[model samples]
Target chain A: MKDRLEIVASGFGGQGVVRLGQTLGEAAVKQGLRVTMLKSHGTEMRGGYVRSQVVLSQKAIDSPMCETPDVFLALSSSAYNRFKDTVPAEGIIVYDPAFVEEIDASLPCRQIAVPAKDIAVRNFKRPIFSNAVALGSLAKLLETMLEKNVVLESFLEVIPKYKDENRNAFEMGYETMNI
Target chain B: MKRFLETGNFAITEGAILGGCRFFCGYPITPATELAEAMSLRLPQVNGVYLQAEDECAAMHLCIGASLGGMKSMTATSGPGFILYADPYGWALGCEAPMVVMNSGRVGPVSGITGAPGQGEFYLTRYPTQGGNFETITLAPNSAQECLKIIVEAFYLSERLRMPITVLGDQLLTDGMEDISVPENDDEMKEMGLRVWPRLYHKGPDFYPASDALDIPPVQMGYDTGALCSDWTPTVEGYDIEEVEEHHKHAYRLIYKVRNNPQLYEDFYEKKYMDDDPDLVVVSYGTPSRVVNTAVERARSEGLKVGALRLINLWPFPDRHFSRKTKYLVVELNWDGQLVREVQRAAPKDAEVKFLGCCGDLPTIPDLMETFTKMLKNQPLERKGWVLEAW
Candidate 1:
């Protein structure tokens, strides 16, 4: 595991971008790691730009702004275009193909496509659980730094309403990831 | 200690409750609105009172009223709402009401941006209300965990100083989430350096004392102690007085009580790599200082002589930290350079001072590193279309 892990998730509003970051941050805190999560959103409630920057470290985190994210979760085309270059050559960019139709092939970082929205719709019949799918993929990617069961438990604790569906969606996401 | 990833607003709400703030009256505004919402939910669970006022002025006035009635009171607002607090803020100051006012600042001359952070209120907090004959106590904590301790300390200081204390935060600090460990009991609270001064009503016919004293219990209503609370210049016995000598005594107490009692908050600052006297000192407060600290640490690793001076206690200026003659750079979240002027005034006459200003967003580390390199080499920072003049 790296000394510091930076995870950035950006999409339009109401996409649970902040919630995704919060769940990961909660899991990191439960693991006794220092974490900082900063969420910025546009004025409108929906369809406005939204971004969540989460930084986790074993020691104190000085800068909350994720300048170079170890993992970039691009949930939308605009988000993918905006932060694609911020991922270093060794980092990974996990993007949802439903929102990010086009990918930047010239980027040095490994770009993986996760059909979170389609998987959520096919299984849960709702796009709201797409965040769970995304988290599952992130959990698989961050296996070295975070415990998968701990992340799942924290995710359930944050979104407590759906238990079985979220768990299934998470497992599906974890299975779908190329990692 | 119980750890949770929470926003600064949540931490501050718990801090206020732990600090014996039983009453909170505030109007909702962006960034600071969540604080009032948290207070509304948490205050009732602890058998406290939460009121949503019609406006910012009424909210602060209600807090003042609750404070006068022997309750540790508080209010929260953003920059635009804070301007409306000018009237009640002065009233609380003149009446010596013990309360806490939190200004979670956003970009604004007047409501420029509702959701973004700004440090335009650096000077506004010092001179919050018109006709400044008093010294204001404002604490700017850099993180969510520190916000809890700072709010608790603010409530403690307000009671001891017998005046309103301000907790200045920006949107990022108040709304950002981090791992915050809340105390489970009084022992834990004490271990975290949190202090709480119970609201004490003065048992006196002389509620308005002429002497500049610390821990003089504020005048509380319904005590039947002949205590008077008014905005007018008050006599020693709590009568409305117009004589210059009486006003002078009242003003003297208002000013010197905080100025003379610097020990209460003088230690509220952080110095990194400053013992050996680095060639450059980066001075800042609030959320911006977090990035500055990171940049300074990185600069030191690269063999650059740079230090960071972060002020938690913003008012009374903490001029002692700037007594050294060195190249100083003041970074803030405003383009107009408010805190830079104070650094220029407080630093030695021959010391070089500069300003790096950005609004609506935090300054990037690369920008800070580049600027540090320039300042160390004695090269001018030439950003196109920027004046870059001396503060």
Candidate 2:
């Protein structure tokens, strides 16, 4: 069986980490792929660390939990340090340079740091849209399977009223990703 | 249609309404509070009555009263609230009033967590209520969609059997959201008999009229009897029971009626999957059964030839289905081996029974898969206890 792709998104609570994971999982489901999304939150809803794992495959997923992730998206420095070691050898580490300033320089996997929060604030006028920007970047990285337009459409489906801001945030991330 | 994406709570509320439930009384409890909130908002639009009672006990009793008055009624509460309504639940059983109780279970024995999921109430609902000889029908759904479908069925079954039925749902199923097709119209529902309530009491002044009495109202409690009183003892002509033999006879008759007419279960998979004259059977229910089902499929793929038996109706335990070929019986549940004991007693003497249990907020599917793999491989299955942390 082909290996399934598992993505883990981590950040502080209320950073849209859960929503970002859900949007990607829903996009996968919409594309006729089997997906499972598992989310965990700490006691405090605002500052405590929150994480979500999204598993995608052509076959039915047996368990929702992911022990090793293929891609780890850490929007906060603390979350990056906490989960960086769990990524597999061939995994990719994507971080927000605006918040996560340091990373283990000797890590084996490919690393990409983007100014997600800066882009969100500068272009969308909302720092909360950073997660949407990160989602667009992640979609670009997985361009072989998912289209940038599909990710933008899924983001629109989730953020019901903020059409212009969300679209701009997604576009900024799409343009930033060299891939 | 206004496509307001709904939560699991709203789905269940809509399903209950589709089931013809016109009266809902409940107390607010976490995880389950959303169910009441949705019902409160929608009930008025449908011309239904939704009351938030002072406490769970009052809420349960209020549902019983509404049900007795011949309106399809229900109540939703969590574990703590379920305990409070134990007495009222027993009374409803004794009186043979049909109503549905939705238990959106959370972690606990005593308010463990407000927003976590737990399947600890598996055995509590499986047994008879407050020293009764019979068990109420309990249905557990793994997904929010099933939550919607099952509550409607619960009402139908409860009314059909003249017994209170419970939808034993956990926070995972109650709080999660899913895409569900809206239910059909009243005419379609009537065609499927989803709106029908069974004949319990005799109808009208005349027992047998010259014409077909299809339009006459059924002879309900207050209309048929002269007086209304809250007496536990069976009263003949509205007087307190003086005869001991008559009271015993009345109680025994009611108990026997329910016990004898136990609801038969619907086996999810075929009996042949029990194996080509296989040596073991795995007994499970609810969410655990879904894991078992996955494990059985995996085992079959590995050429182990194992099978699963899931009890849709846990209460009316299908004792008649036990067989000599069933050599080993494994009972898996989310509680600390609570239902295993019952399965062990019910299995044949030649069959060896074992328990693979957990009290974790969410039972690990991998653990179940590993256990089933070991059992099918003829390896010794490890026995351990699990105590999940409070949220």
Candidate 3:
């Protein structure tokens, strides 16, 4: 089997999709793995589809763009419906249960539904921290490339002002994963 | 060093510092104005001089003068500002002064959107600046990270080749944000041998001063009056009509010397892909080239024998590399097929050169793939405007 793992984090604008991909890429880099991150954003600043693809590999990354995603994270219903077909059959699809209600169960892929938004606003007191929560859960699932503490530290480095709330969000995400 | 988060503007400032740019002169233009603003704030800390000229013309002239004065100098501007500096830029090309100009292009024919990105200046850039045998080295960077690398290389190439170098970027690359690792000090820069700006003009007692007539000397603002000359004739001590032939010969020599020594091109792929026996070749440059490469790889996986050729240097056109074995040629550019004519001229007459063009300010990877996929299936290509159609 190939040692490369392709992860695509997609959601509406301001949902921190790009940041989540960047954090995972940074974590992989800290672990001595080659990483490439590609992101696309819409013209509008808010409420548009934002997606980022992160490729983690042991060898040099030949191309940064991802043709097929191994782990697909969809934070919005529109994003899930739009990109669900691009997910590989053997891959995993993670969705925010609060927003994404319907996922095609016919596709041969594992699914994980988590209350990512409610946990962020209620436990962390910041709805924006939901991205960090999603990222923490992703780090736990992709156990080979990243560690929970490493993702938490990367989040803290980027969001130093809200360290305690971010920590709580990370813990909630990690516990939700039940890893 | 303060660990504050840096934007693309500040990253360019850091690049200028690392590139040993001792002087900066510019007039404000959107997208590129931040580069000047950051230089004004940071250059003083490094003991470098920064000046705001009356306009882009004066800005480019000041930069050329500073470079001639044995200092590493630069300037920044957008499309409208770039048009104003055309005359002085031609002068710099004729004089072979080493300098760098960062053009953060925005939407424009005259003055379009100040904030949006545009690649409309592709043809203007490829056109010969001085109407002679000279070639200007232009580097198009796609991302902010490439912006820093290209700036450093631009300085090195300009000094080593003794010609004006341009870093062509759009509002996307210039205004976009990304994380980059800045070099610690100028030691790495010095090791690159780029700091040899004030080149030694003499060795021992037998000294020949650097002159604009023979040696292209560095001249300060208020230097010796004898060093300045606007006359077309070359005289030993002063201007004279009898030495007109000598001046023409010297100018031809400078132009031909640069034509002989072209800049280094980072061909995106190896010859295995661009070998003599390719079914079809898709040609692109800058960020779009990256997307084309991806599409080519995808097509290859599906059993389509296709290849791509990307140009790191748009000028000098790499005439030596084109061969007869190459088949269909498709030119993909952001402008309305600006570079297609040049590509057609460079290829064999029998070769069919097609244009897959766009002028939508920014062309995405998917858009390019869609167009390429259709072309590979033998579909007719779309033409953009009267200009491309005329060709």
Q: Per-residue CA lDDT of candidate 1, range B1-391, in tens?
A: 8898999999999999998899999899889888999999999999999999999999999999999888999999999999999999999999999899999988888878776889988888999999878889999999999999999999989988888999999999988999999997888998888874456778776788887788788888776676667778978787777788889998999999998989999999999999889999999999889899999999999999999999999998988998988999999998889999889889999999998999798999999999999999999887645675554
Better of 1 and 3 by TM-score: 1
lDDT of 2 by residue, B177-277 (tens): 43344556766555544443443553334421222112323224565554232536444343445467656654664455446555333431224277475
Interface RMSD of each: 0.9, 4.4, 6.1
Candidate 2 has which clashing residue pairs, if any?
A: none
lDDT of each: 0.91, 0.69, 0.67
Q: Score candidate 2 by TM-score against the native.
A: 0.80
- In terms of lDDT, the poorest run of 10 residues in model 2 chain B is B207-216
- Per residue, candidate 3 scores C-alpha lDDT tens digits across B24-131 of 999987778779999999899989999999999999898888876767889988889988878777777655567888887776678766655666676666542545
Q: What DockQ, on C-alphas, does every prediction get? A: 0.78, 0.23, 0.11
What would the TM-scores of all predictions be?
0.97, 0.80, 0.74
Locate the minimum summed-lDDT window of 10 residues in model 1 chain B.
Answer: B382-391
- With a 3 Å backbone cut-off (N, CA, C), the pairs that clash in candidate 1 are none
TM-score for candidate 1, residues paired by index: 0.97
Task: Report the TM-score for the A-chain of model 2.
Answer: 0.94
- Per-residue lDDT, model 2, residue B311, is 64
lDDT of 1 by residue, A1-179 (tens): 57789999999999899989999999999999999999887777788988999999999998899999999999999999999998999999999999999999999999999999999999899999999999999999999888999999998998898899999999999999877
